[model samples]
Target: MAAVIDLNEDVHTLLPLTEHRPIGTLPFAGRYRLIDFPLSAITAADIHSVGLFMPESERSVQDHIRSGAAWNLDLIQGGVFLFPYVATRDYQNDDLRARYYENYTQFLRGSGSKYTVVMGAKNVANVNLNAILNYHKAGDNRITTVYKKLPLDRIRPTDWTLALSEQGTASAIVQAKERHDDQGKNEIPSFMDIYLLATTDLIDLLDDAAQSHVFRRLPELLRDYVLANNANAFEYTGYLARIDSIQRYYDSNLQMLDDASFQSLLLSSVPILTKSKNEVPSFFAKDATVVNSLLGTGTYIEGTVQDSVVFRNVVIHHDALVDHAVVMQGSKISTGSTVKYAILDKGVVIGPNLTIVGKPDKPIVLRKNQTVFRESEVEGSAHA
Candidate 1:
């Protein structure tokens, strides 16, 4: 099976601290990037011929994914191909689904591959395509989409929702403008973003959609094409989070710091991939007190830190107090400064005797490269 990794859309919403950098390149857990998840998934599945679907991100994306060798995607037989958007001669309007179908069709036509599996970089899941491929081969279905169940409250801010049928079959479950009203019942649908399609079937559908100028999403187009046709659903019962916003991103990182059980789920079978940083070990000075925090490599702490994540190269000065916060790379907390429930971006500096605090509902965000004066109220600086 051929795996296609989609890196077209910007995933900056997830990494709010580093808005300048793309989500795929954002520093995750001390060393890895967000794109490492999908790359690791495909590598674990042994899918060598992975086609990266990137349309607009030409400059920065190329530098990051130069050859895909970091994730073992640089293969001899079926390596990775960076596909650019191929616009048709006659264009109607700006249509997202139309662009998706056309771009994928062009990729398939250029490269002669049989089976195709589409994946995105947002979700963090170690999925082995062996089971899904076996299911596809056993049945006569033309398409298969990956889905996982999510809580009702957690389902509000996401794009994909599962709308299951009585027969337990999955129908159209994609990006909805608003939650679809199904009478008085409040049944949510499974979000199906990752799609799998046969080479021939995908070509046919793309051609049809292109000719009709109907730029419907993959789920909607496929649903309409196959009125009574079989579209299988492969349930993924693992740890998965479609990191969408800043809060979710921070929360997901903190979740990885969970004790044995939760951490075991990811490192158990297929390990997640990321760029390796060979840095020195972390050091703690005298009188340093750290509690419930994730301290990365090359960090020096001499103060009290509680319930926080301190990334690489962070420094906590003497007499400083930090709680329930996220400190990015190269951040410094000076002496006598107190920080609570705030997100300090990379290279940020908090001066001595300053008090910066934020609540759980609304986290105080200090912009990148910003500095706070000593003995100043952070609330006033936030407004300024």
Candidate 2:
């Protein structure tokens, strides 16, 4: 078996600490990366040949992936290869076909494999593919995708939501708002934003999708052609969160610190693995006061931090106070400044004595190397 990670350029919606960096390489959970979840899942499933569809812009992703030694994705069967740009060479090079070729070539590289599991990296979860693959083989389905049930009322119209039949088979894909609960049971299945496809069947599907560019997302394209025609789904009831929006990214990180129940949910089974930072333990000065926060290694907290996430190499000055915020690596919180409900990206600096705070609905996002004077709100008021 093999796993494919779509490292598309547009996946930057994950709000990476470094703007130019790819979402998968983005520092996550203080020590791990966003791609760790999916990579770990593939590793645990004993799937060695992992195809990472890296875009040309973010060559750093290719460099960092580094032979997949960190995640044990390096196997004799299939090497973790950074796929080259073939879309431009191919005739049917529209968005849909480009993606098809991208996935197809990656799978083609693993031609001997029986099944291919396509997944997104930004979402933090440990899904047991062994179960899903077993079920798929048992059902004799051409295509199978991992679906998570969603609360209908909570789903928005534009957000992608799945509709399943009485037998729990995915029949129609619809807008979250347009979803009706009255049909048999109010079961709403939302795609985990991940999929599993038969190796031979996926190649055939991609070949067909290349001809017809009606849909962009593979799941939607498959639903229109495969599922709607043949009917199948492998639902996964597991802990998952798509860390797309900035708010969701900040909220999920904070939730990791505060919610034990949520933490247990993910850590309970299918442990997620990541490249070890191998940094020294966090240092807290005598002047530092921290409460209910998760401070990563290599952090030097001399100031006051409350309910926050302080990543590696963060320096909180003696008098600075940070509350309910996520401060990325290599950032400096200067003396006498107070930052609340904000995310300071990598290399960010808060000038001495500045105060920046935003409403809960709209938190502030500061780019890298940007500085805001003490008691000053440098950005995001207009957005707020």
Candidate 3:
């Protein structure tokens, strides 16, 4: 199988986090990045070749997925290929597959496979593509998409929604809209925006969509394809979290604290792969008081930490209190600092005696390399 990942610009919604890096490289689950879920799924399907259509932060992407060795995509031939799109300020990639049609087509032509799997990375889930591929092969359809039935509010309003027929065929897709009914039974079929199609069929669809001029975006074009052609929908019954908003991001991370949710997503059948960093085991100082937290390698805790996710090489100085927060790699919480319900990105530094607080409804977020002064009150920002 040939695969192409569209690290779409929709990641911009993930603000401050996406401000400095692609969502794919955004740290998740204490250690792994967002892209690891899809890449790991592709590798599990035994698809050796991959073409990443990166439109932003090309350097950062290269650093994380360097040589694709972790995903077993380091093969001599048909390994990993990165296509960085360099366009003008007003450029929007939703109109076309790549900067130019020739670019995407070139990758398709040389992928040396019959089927192609196209996806967007914001949706985090550990799915087995082999099952979806088998469903496509069992039928004579030209395309197959993955979807789940859930409340519309669970995902973003811009996410694609699918209404399926009794026969399991997807009939119509709409830009997700909110339902006012707080009733627990109101659920809609939401598309995961993952597709599998034959290479020849994809080329044909591209030519058709271009000529019609009515469908320029890949998802819109595919929506029409499902309507016209015999496209099927495969129901994905697993943990699905679309990190389109900051609240959603924070909620999803905290949800990982649940053993069932954590086991199903990270310890599922497919092994999630990430760039390995060699670091010493975490050290807890005698002055530390920690409980119910996920601490990564090289993490040094000397403060009071409860119910948080701390990444590698982080330093929590003495007299600090971190409660119900997510702190990324290389962050230093100075002595006498207190951070609650916050997310500290890479290399962040908190001054001595600083106090940052947030509610469960709105968590504080400090971007990469951000610094906070002592005795500061960080509230109402939903962003720190």
Lowest lDDT sum, 10 consecutive residues, model 2, at 375-384
Per-prediction TM-score to the true structure, in the order listed: 0.83, 0.87, 0.91
Measured over all alpha carbons after superposition, the RMSD of each candidate to the real structure, in angstroms, is 4.0, 3.4, 3.1
What TM value does model 2 have? 0.87
* Residue-wise C-alpha lDDT for candidate 1, range 1-384, written one tens digit per residue: 677776645555644454565555555665566677777877877777777766443555577677878778777766778766443342446464466677667777765767877776777676777777877776556777677766555565446754555665565554444555545553445554566778788789777877675455444565554334546777877777666777766677666667762475467577876656788898898899988888889899999988887899999999999888888889999999888877888899998877887777567778778888843435533332
Write the candidate numbers in order of decreasing lDDT: 3, 2, 1
Better of 1 and 2 by TM-score: 2
Which parts of model 2 have CA positions greater than 4 angstroms off?
A: 9-18, 85-103, 152-154, 182-187, 211-220, 374-377, 381-384
lDDT of each structure? 0.70, 0.72, 0.81
Q: For candidate 3, lDDT tens digit of each residue in 172-262? A: 6666664333356577777887999998888777766555534255656777888787577888988888878888888888778788888
- How many residue pairs clash in each candidate at the backbone level? 6, 6, 0
lDDT tens digits, residue span 21-133, model 2:
76677666666677878888887898877777775455668666777888876666676867654343443457645665656655665557888888876666778889888
**Candidate number of the best lDDT:** 3
Model 1 / residue 260 / CA error / Å: 5.4
Highest-scoring model, TM-score? 3
Better of 1 and 3 by TM-score: 3
